[model samples]
Target: MPDTAASSTHLTLLDDLLKRALAHGADAADAVMIRSDSVGASWRMGKAEDLERSESTDVGLRVIRGKKQAVVATTDLNPAGFDELAERAIAMAKVSPDDDYCGLADPALYATDLQDLDLDDHPDQGAERLIARAREAEEAALAVKGVKQSEGGSASVGRTTMALAIRGEGARFEASYSASSHSVSCSVIAEDGNGAMERDYDFSSARHFEDLDSPADVGRRAAENTVRRVGARKMGSGKMPIVYDPRVSGGLVGHLSQAVNGASVARGTSFLKEKMGQKIFADGIRIVDDPLRQRGLRSRAVDGEGVAVRRLNLIDDGVLQSWILDTSTARQLGLETTGHAGRGTGGPPSPGPTNLYMEAGRLSVDDLIADIQEGFYVVELIGMGVNYVTGDYSRGAAGFWIENGRIAHPVSEMTVAGNLKDMFRQITPASDLTFRYGVNAPTLRIDGMTVAGA
Candidate 1:
């Protein structure tokens, strides 16, 4: 049982520790404390199989003296342990390299008006309850006719609190988030006894349990998806239009986003380097990275480096607008930080996007497909083969064959290859956009992709 009251007290203690670190030896200090609890349950063969519940807290201290800086973290939060951690961090900072850019963020850049977003409010669902839900989902999937084996079904709940404090600057912020997820997967042996096809469906709800999809719904969808792939075959190789379902399109967008990070740009590993203000995509394509999306999984008032977050237009009407940036990478490139820093206690902060999404187009998925005579509607991809520097893109894909504006048959064991530069310029998005994850996009169609199949 986790006590919210105790968590709040611990957060205050962490703030006090930051002040103490600055007083002890560090010219500046920042502290972060995170407490998280999670419950997970899995079911197989229509019965509860695995159940897990865990709670943990981690505290990190970053000390800076001029250009020298060091970070130390520990799961121990006891009074003596906390004091020792601060001392160790200060001592480590003494021997660190003097990089002129390494220091706490300027006080002027700190966020002041923090929003009261309730990210951790959820009904209490015990381990038994989660196991029951998992069993129900598994049973529902097994009930579908022709379903041969259930891979597994699961339900999970998680709660997390994050607190940060910067000394002297007197900036502090705390936020919490709660989430629940349910997933089911099933495999069906084809009637021809030649192959087995597996598919999965998952639904995740944040902030409230009522937002979650029903276990039966997840199970039924998993079964339906598996059945549809029972007779999958290979198609002949050729250049054709490729339609990507929303789930697959999101991943494709993620790869592109990674290539636009300031770190990649500074390291000369991104193909988008020096392409700012240039046309990078089709005329209708637009992409935005918004950190203020209400109840968004990645939404935060301040970035990891304590900079206020804001919406950024990475691409507007096909033109490259800006690259995602963190403090260090931004300074390296002589650009301002874009409030995209993502930090963990284990490593230095890195640039990242929050709630990155592609702007939806006006055409529906069906309407987008109607104009294509032959294509592949990609549902999933396997293996990463994208080259950020050269912009060469190739991936193993599985999907359904689209013929005459309708999905005709399932296809598998194919490779789709194209250059990122050309792919971005030729891609088109459908209007059926759904916000299911931190990064989202609508179904997208790419013209003239080389499909390598039998």
Candidate 2:
């Protein structure tokens, strides 16, 4: 850890331990330090129901001797504690069994220049403010006409600091961010004596509270979504085009991408083995992983291994471009790291996407559905039924009916089944691109999917 005067001084302590490890018969070493603070408040039935606040700091060190490596981590930040931890890590490394694949990243691959990212920095607003926000969101939900009882509402805030250092190639960075989120949900009893409806809305803001969604707006949307679900019925089972809203589309794409990772390929478990440069999807489909998006939820200047991060094309114009790779997996497969390493003190690094997103399409959501005689606009899915090695896919789905380009009624308790390989090639995307989460996608349409229902 480079020297810093802030709370992240534990980073320096970690750096010092790494140096000690190198001097104590280790070939390579690295260190990481992290500090975080969080607060939360909840309101229900017009009263405060729960509140919590906490802060914590931790440091970890790793040592590698030839083919053997060991790691030790501790939340205690005192100098004496750090020294003991370092000694223990070296001792563990000495006794560890040697494997051919364990080592620190090459010095040539380390990032030198650090990027100045703008993360959250706001004065701590006490529990009272959090409670107030929770109450406001809940009250707005309860005020809706058909809302009989609010299930609950909550507000939360979190701040974090992180630092990293490597032995021979010293690199250091410090970043802090603040995030707040509020959510409200309610159950509505219909006036016609038909049944009950339920829904919820959530709003999140980073940097400050002013960026959050209005309580009234959240409440109204929740009420609308809930009301639409009333009297949902099952549809006849058949193969048809399926449209996935942005929220659900992201999850669908994520599942597909995970199966294409290089680690899985190296292990002979990826369905995409030997499919590089092959046409794997519709002509318009593209999947990209970007780590430098400004203020992006998962954006980072460097990967977990201190490698420079950049945008990578996983799939371009339906062609399988590349698979996500970490250092170990890349080495095993004779490829370069894709700057997708995800690891911490306790485990080896794994490949993961940074701000993964699918490129938007030309047609608006309505236009994409206009020609469909019948379809389903999926809003949510439950339970997982995906086989990475075989590319088989199935899941429980619930959403609204699409008829002649219009949303008709909600449908529930159905199953969607198809081969992921076929589904990718048959899919189409809508023009609506909303950036609300780490994984994002436009509304997507997959044709000829099997929907199991009555």
Candidate 3:
């Protein structure tokens, strides 16, 4: 049962896969094995709505023949299927189009410093605990005076074991022992005098159950946000200082992440493609990616290619310093890999950021907004109207209006538009940064954005 639940046997299978690929007319190959177990529950209106549990074990093989490459994935763990899997991958590679930049990372560049990131929290949080947590979240949300109904409250626990194996200059193997996650969320609806309704939600997640915010706190926050949005009115259109709450402000940095992604830059599809080594943000702005943060949601010791991953200052003092790169994209640009390769079970590695965040400035959220006389403080954004290719930005937004340097009234049905190229340059971050998501930023105040409304 221990072996079934989790095992190091995948390491042996990786070697077997690589050997079979070489025997089947392949020059090189890599394998990835993933095993996952998860359980979840949802509670609504004081009753359990559903209980769910699942387990899946899957493996993928990628083969290279000269300049051609192919990938195949399967769930059949029967050792009998691996040989056929390798043969089929090689056959596909034989007819595949040649990609000049496709190849394994240089053997000399493999990560040697294995760091324990404390990613997994053991003693499995059982199904009963998950359901109980869900019930607590729902009851707490419903307890709020103005909250009319609970959209739903949910709790989940999941664990994953991952291994990567490759045959390149020589054989190499690395495996993520395990990663576990716990999450709880609640949503509530509130009604205004005229029966108009508004809904809001909040959630907390962590690698360890103990790190999650109290279920009551999550529920109360959801209720408070929903009630506050009731009967929101529209604001006038104008170009003004736009403030971003930490929740949605991270999106601004998210756009920056996409702009600096190596794949997009290599394909000539990014707005900042030619802006390398140039000042992209305000002089005080700094952006970083850290892959070794203990308990971080996106933390990892090594990238998909087993390249040594480390923290990088992607944007240092406003200058674009690095492109998130994997071996493939780095080669295409005639540069060295930056160890930013991210992969999945069915696709080639892609360059992406992990635990990306912006450094905070020496200003509180209130202090950051104190200077704004007439501005929009965004709490919610709807729709995807961003165009990274041209740096154009437009989005549906709702939040509060800052009047005389204070958040005054709830506002909705407004549209905010600007060019990201300008947004980044004018953004000033507050000193309230928190690492709560894959991409995080503090409350930010951006100057000169067009807010359109009544």
Candidate 4:
């Protein structure tokens, strides 16, 4: 656990800033305070390459006068700077444009429990240790049979402490949280004897150092994947099932996130704007946003607006059930906030997801693809040719080909095109869901996509 006393100190600063804003002729206000420490190192070709470390503090003040709000941020936290910053913010609010739906969140929704979420960890390492990690990872990758050139291996770690405080009509409170992370990665090229080459990479991140994958293992995985990609050929143009590997499948769910964002629905620009309570995916499909998950990469004890966030069943049994909503977006659509408010120093609250993932289905990956006579198993997505408003999807893709329910040669330089609305309805998941990123899905299969070829 992070030092409770340190968090309290930071929270006090935020509390004082909010009070200062209210004292300076603002009707209500909130403040964000952050402190961070980071370190990184890199190595290549059996030698140390570089090292870096940094520490910083940032504080931002947002003051509301009646229906207007203004925000200001600074790295200077001097007592003298605090008063001037708050006074300036209040002054700016007087000339700001008015908004009917802008203000503090409903006081009743404020978070009270702050300590139960385990969002912090301790990683004790310096330049020497980081460099050693990078060196070992690169060495492991270069040891692989067909692995040739090293793109370098790297390691990084960081710690951050954040606090938010709010003051309104009769409500006043503050919440603080801390986060720590450690990660190692490697990228390398694999060369075939006939002068063909391919590159791939793997990485792992965790709140605690001990939870990270071994450096050697990360490097080995990267090299193995790259070596497997050597001599990749092209497939023919046709309509076929496109299976998404776990590494890249999360992006499919990300598209769903954007479609269901309340802001898009409010503006009538999302393809899924009118899809509420409708069956949008195959039966048994479910997606969730969980903010209280222990050590989650995007977990938060309280939301960006000081509201108590909760787990949301965004998609329930293949039906579109909810929109990711913040206080303002929800009001625009005549609904309650879904506890998805996210904000930074100089902007209004916006809807966002936290620890989002789709539930696994009942079939193993092998079983899921056993019936495919010919298909493409995607490994990497190259560009963003997505149209959220029209639901059109086109992107450069590379992966292996599946023939007669078995893996064939690797394929590259292909384009997959389809409509997301149609793609969602046809997507079938395999029971291999592993929580590896902020957005995660298992091996997924989509039928009837037009795969453009060489």
Candidate 5:
């Protein structure tokens, strides 16, 4: 984790920058500082391939004059340079095109009573541990029978600190937070006697080092996944049921997110633009976005814009409940901000989800697949063939074929096609939801999809 002394210094620096921007004839301003340190190691075939360590600090300032705003970024932390940075921002804002919705958030809505989400952890041991982790993972993967070659193993640990300060009419705010992350991953190829080779990989990440999966466990899982695809064959073309494993099921939820993004909806480019208060999914389905989840991968007490954050039901009872929004997009749609704003050093704030997930269903994985006699169980997806405007979905897929309600053989080089509108309506959720990614869903089964293969 980052030291408190450094965090305090960053907050002070942001405050000084915001004050300078205001003094230079800007109506309102906000400044953010980000500092990061990371260590990584990669090992392949029992030898260390690379070792890396990095540290940096970056700052961005947004200044608004009247209805126009300008943003500037810099890596130089010298206080003497702040005057020129502020002056440049104000001058740019003066000549910038007018935008009615380009200012700070409402002062009344500023976040207060921030909570500790426990996102940071103790410091890492060093590069030595990371190298050992990578070596161990590669060795474990090579130990598995049928495994032909190692694709290398990797481990990384990182910490980031963010500080923000806002100076607007009747409102002044400052906040700082730090978070840590650790990850281990392994990839390997398996070959059958016929000279056919398949590759698979697995990895686990968490906010704390102690929560990550063991290197051996990751290696074994990756090897097992690779071994299963040793004898993959292409199936025939036909329309059938499709069951998505947990690894790929989250993509469906991501599509939903894009369809409901406030920016896309405002631009009239989303298929779900007119889906408010409509049944977009099967009955009894619920989807949630919670930013306050303890130790969540993307958890935060407040959004990137210093707005209060909370849990929201983006979907409830299979109905479209809310749109992912920020202050600017919300204003364009004549709605209040949903506190979903996110930002980086080079651009303005935008709306996005944090800790988004779908609720699990009552049916088990086996029960979900029991009813499908001839279907495709998708484990991997390829291509970006989704049309958000029309909801037309088509993607290259690979996985196993289902015969007699059981996994039969691996299939590859297949394309699955269906309209998302129909797919969402025909979807069924299984009781295997896990919180492994920022966006999560259970094992999903969608009926009435077409599969094309040899």
Candidate 6:
């Protein structure tokens, strides 16, 4: 929960807005309010480059008349505009085309109790502290051996308060929650003095500032990564196993989530549309979406639609189990809402995963790649060359070459291509999973990928 007084005030405003909608002949209505504040600082070459702060309050209201719906948003908080906003929404709904699936969550499905997830931990660490953090990171990076120059270091702190209210049949639903984030990032260039140079970056983000990695550590990591990529060359084209480091392996899991989104499934735009209850991954693979994780980057007690949310095993023992779904998409697909709704002031709610991750596998990273005579250990991916409709995948890649079961040298200007269905079936995860991002996975090895070098 956020500040009790603030939450109460936002809820009251939303409730009043909903009442106005109902009074304007809307059958049902819902409203959401978001308040956010953030501060950021950037440093380069021992000097502060920039420091900035922002604050905003925005709201969205949706009204439904029979099967038609309309959504409106505003940054104006004056109560005097509530009547016009409601009236505009009601008029739009009256003239809008019917959408059989448009409506609020069922009253019975609304989350009644808000649980404390320990998401807020931002204190009044002012601009001076932020600048100090950024400067420390940049200075540390420049201290690393083989690190030639600094790109920049940045630190940011942010807090958001969200409230949702729904008008139901003789019942009213309202909920409020708050979260805070702190992050530090450093990017630098490393050179071998033979004109070989490469750039890399590292960052740490957490709900609590205490949980974030120290500025020095982040800078050192960024420098080390950049140094390793110096003197990079290209590996010749071949079809072999491709190993994805933990940092980039999460993308594979994210692709799976997108394929299982109810919107795509309903529209037949996902290659996995027919894969429900089928073995989509290797045996023993499990993927989970948990919105209730205490300190997770995307944790939430309830979904954006004011529906109760729980952890879901999206994949259980390699079998596809559930689609990521919001209310409208679930209705269109003739299934119940999976409570994966994500909302923004400018658009209607849509399905998305929160705190999604694949469970770690049995083998260590060293053991997982022990037998690979030739492979690509991918560290970075570029371009969005994925075709969700066909599951065909291709991407520009840069990483190290694995030769004779060891990382040999840095490689660049490469392409990795394969169908996702085949790649998913060949995935072998390692026991190196870490919860450092919204979507996470262990280091993964996928066999039979086409690796081409320029």
C-alpha RMSD values across all candidates: 2.6, 2.8, 1.8, 1.2, 1.2, 1.0
lDDT of 3 at 425: 95
Global lDDT scores for all candidate models = 0.78, 0.74, 0.88, 0.89, 0.92, 0.93
Winner by lDDT between candidate 3 and candidate 2: 3
Candidate 4 on 79-154: residue-level lDDT in tens? 6678899999988899999978888888888877764666666678588888988988898999999998999899
Best by lDDT: 6
Among all windows of 10 consecutive residues in model 1, the one with the lowest summed lDDT is 181-190
Q: Residue 213 CA error for candidate 5 (Å)?
A: 0.7
Residue pairs with colliding backbones in model 6 are none
lDDT per residue, candidate 3, 1-454, as tens digits? 0132444688787788888889898888888888888899999998898899999988888898899999999999888888999889988999999999998999888887768888887737587887788888888888888899888999999988888888854756555567888899999899888888888999999998889998888888888888888888997899999999999999988899998888999999999999999998989789999998999999988899888899999999999999989999999999999999987779778899999999999989889888888999999999999998999999999999999999898899999999999999999999999988989999999999999999
lDDT against true structure, model 6: 0.93
266-367, model 5: which lDDT tens digit per residue? Answer: 999999999999999999999999999988999988887889999999999999999999999999999988999997878788999999998999999999
Comparing 2 and 3 by TM-score, which wins? 3
Q: Give stretches of model 1 more than 4 Å off.
A: 1-8, 168-192
Query: In lDDT terms, how accurate is model 2?
Result: 0.74
TM-score of each: 0.93, 0.92, 0.97, 0.98, 0.98, 0.99
Order by lDDT, highest first: 6, 5, 4, 3, 1, 2
Can you tell me which runs of candidate 5 are displaced by over 4 Å? 1-3
List ranges where model 4 is wrong by over 4 Å. Answer: none
lDDT string, candidate 6, 360-382, tens digits: 99999999889999999999999
Candidate 1 is scored at a TM of 0.93
Cα shift from native, residue 451, model 3 (Å): 0.6
The segments of candidate 6 whose C-alpha lies over 4 angstroms from its true place after superposition are none
Clashing pairs in 1: 119-177
